[model samples]
Target: MTTERRVLVYGANGYTGKIVSESLANRGIPHYFAGRNREKLEAALSIVAERFGSPVDAEIAVASNNPDELRPLFAKVDVVINVAGPFMQMAWPVVETALECGCHYTDTTGEQDWSRAIAEQYGQAFADKGLLLAPATSYMWSAGALAAEIVLENKGVDSLDIIYQIDRGLPSEASTKSFLRMVCNDQLYLDLNEYAAWDWDTLVDVHVPYRGASIRAFPWGGACEPIWYKDDPRVLNCKVLTAMGEHLIDGVKMAIDKFHEEALSLSQEEREAWTNTVGDTMHQGEPPKDNVTAQRSCIIVGGQGQTTTVQYVMNLSAPYTWTGEVSAEAAKQLLAGKLLKPGFQSVATAFNHRELLQTFHELGFTSAPPAPGTL
Candidate 1:
């Protein structure tokens, strides 16, 4: 086995993959791009080589969504960063093969069902397979969650809430498609108990801001609401919300929600309904001419600590970007024989967080605002 800490980037054809690879290259980190499509591989590499103005040197391998080819791909690499998402649908084969090959797994998975499924279903298997499966380590959970954890360390963080809002730049046609494909995955709307719970009639609502525009947001998906809160004994209840709240955007997310629920039970009609709805949302971004700006995301973690203290909002960019780098950086550290822990774990449990934050500060990426309530 070559001692080169080989990193394999799946879905190297997607929008975020391009940036992720660029980020890796900008830092002079070596990684291989693997995907099911050959054309995409060639195109992606062409761009990477051109933009970086450096040697075009990355082993791009094409696996035809075939299990046989994927297995060997894993054995050759130490870490696999999966970007091809809508993971609840496209996750299995690659994930299964990666574990079977005795390689560690990590991905930008934001799907709640995907995360819980991997944990409840394959959590032990990954451990038994002697592999570490880290999911939702991207902009969603990693950056914001870690920052939130940092604030709560000694100050006492009993309940945590993470909200992400990134607008201003409209994604390319391809980018928008990938985003839609991701949101089209099965939605696992559950109560605070980790059991099956999806109640739209009653929701956890809060007034937040977007581009200085105050908006009312209700509970959305992904992170466990009450459970995420309840896990930390101090939190009696916790819920999640997003920029595009269900009530706020009636057509897009509402239809997608029904589709995800129906997808589990194999409902074709519901699936079509979701496809159409997403298509509608897609149509709105065809030309990107209007300078589509995004709203700012804020996470208000409210709990009884010095009387309902709320510090930094998790959805802020600088913190999100910083935390995001934490995931891959941490994985790189782990592969280098640094971080090691088995079973299901959030970003907070990943490393000596102070060092992690220091890495971000050193890079001069994103940062928190000034001290609050300090005269």
Candidate 2:
């Protein structure tokens, strides 16, 4: 149990992992790019060196459900920033190992089930050990949570409605797999401190603050917010809805529903195999140059109470770039001994909103005041 300022980026060969590695390298942070394949790790290290003008380090470590194989790797680093997914299949090994090694852990998981499992099952264990186990530390949920927190800072709001949107971006292979897994999970929402199941087919048209147009969105388990605010007495309800480029109105919903229904009929192994097949075919191996440069993400959070209301909207460019920056920053915070409390924490609870906003601002994200007639 050595207290050292070092990090290990697992699954460093993945698209988001490469970006995170580059971010850490640009910041001159000491880290190891680790994955199962030696060749991929070497290639990722080369890319990091070529892009950042310097090389960090590299390791080949396979994450297994068995903690024995992962404990040694965890012992070598003070913090582990896991960018791997289908987190439902992979997160347990890395997380369990980190806890065993008494190391801080964070991941870029957006799966509500996975996030909730960590928070409810492992949160107390991590807290008992005084080690942070923050998941969903990426743009998927963190961006929205940060925006919601900003509104809740002073205002006494009890319920929230969040809409998330992204433009001109393609999903990476890992992202596609994670999403497929997400679609198969149960949909839920928070209602006055109780968890209630929601129908996935239900869609509503909402105004996207960033796009300045109305689009159809579906309930997305109120991602991370309900879980984050679950025990807080101030919040009574939270609902998160998400949409992307006409997907809901188009055939995407039908396709997703079909897939979900079919997946429900398969065994765990069969479902996993199907997921890999789809991910391999549909996953964007590398985003188009234009997409990476021109993509943007937006989140609108409206918190309403009986008598008062607050709203916040955040627009960020280059979603993957921002994910890398945020994940790298969280790793840095952990390595610097800044995480005082340990538990399954949201990004907003683990990090300062003002500082996060400053980072977003530095990275060219824009925030606007509440929309007209918000209250």
Candidate 3:
């Protein structure tokens, strides 16, 4: 192991990637801003320098998942925070290369299928090498898992109901692409300790504590929690539901339901091609600064056991900003030699919940006191 630890932020030119890079720069964490385009990476670095009011003294590397090209970059870095998404199409090669180079791997993926693939296929390999393979380390899944862990508190909760709500704000182009990809894929949830296909038509009404209204939410796969809590004997069921602003729910659902039907009618190859074209066209540039500054996100977890139930809520501003904060912090912990047992881990599994929550609290995130609650 190198005495001095270093990190590389791959896909540093994307909207979320730029935020992650800026977070690391603000913390004075030395990292290489890396991506396939040198020009874009340089442009992102310039913005970071200006925003942080100090030039980031970091190297810029042009590389992708091409092993011969990426191996050298991976060899020099102790950790890689991959913000690139629709991770299903992009994560495999990058992860494979990271493990081959003996570097810790983490990403901001919320895709259930891809996360499970990493855990099942490469978990053991990473464990054997004593390296961490944590995916979904950003706001989407990691924050939810953290909230679940906090509420469970080893209470032996056997079921989890997770809900995510965000105020009206623009999602990054990468996030929109990921959503497009997800719409065409089969969704899964955990039941009785086994994975089952989710019924997209089954929408449940959830009362949003932040918004103070009930919104209908469909089963959004099991997300990363089912994968994280899969083998844990203490948990037997996990379900995740997500919604945007209440006013937008019906329109978004109608669009998604329509797309899902059309996508499922085609062959796998056709679906992939169609989704890519749609994703490209739907991809908007970076969100406006004012939108990000004014938006807020929430994650609510309802944990139930044979005899007990608890609900926990977390509220944070600027989903993209929080994603950047959490990703940068995870990288910092890994670079500082914090070792996890490896094997496809969630943020909670890889790091201390209290420590992570403390960091978030310090960053202005608020958590509601746990108590008996409805929805």
CA RMSD of each candidate after superposition: 5.1, 3.4, 2.9
Model 3 over residues 260-373: C-alpha lDDT tens digits?
767768886787677777767765667764234567777888889988887778876777778888898888888776755665788787887778788777777545433333
lDDT value for candidate 2? Answer: 0.74
lDDT of each: 0.56, 0.74, 0.78
TM-score of every candidate: 0.76, 0.90, 0.92
* Model 2 poorest ten-residue lDDT run: 366-375
Ranking by TM-score: 3, 2, 1
Give the lDDT of residue 235 in candidate 3: 85
Error of 1 at 305 (Å): 6.0
Model 2 per-residue lDDT tens digits across residues 158-274: 897888877755677787777666655576678998887777666778887535678777664447777777877777898888775563234446646766777778888788777
Q: Clashing pairs in model 1?
A: 143-323, 167-294, 168-293, 168-294, 190-197, 191-197, 225-238, 318-366
Query: Candidate 2, after superposition: displacement of residue 303 in Å?
Result: 0.8
Candidate 1 residue spans exceeding 4 A from truth: 1-5, 169-198, 201-205, 208-213, 224-236, 244-273, 276-299, 305-310, 314-327, 368-375
Error of 1 at 89 (Å): 0.6
Candidate 1 vs candidate 2: the TM-score winner is 2
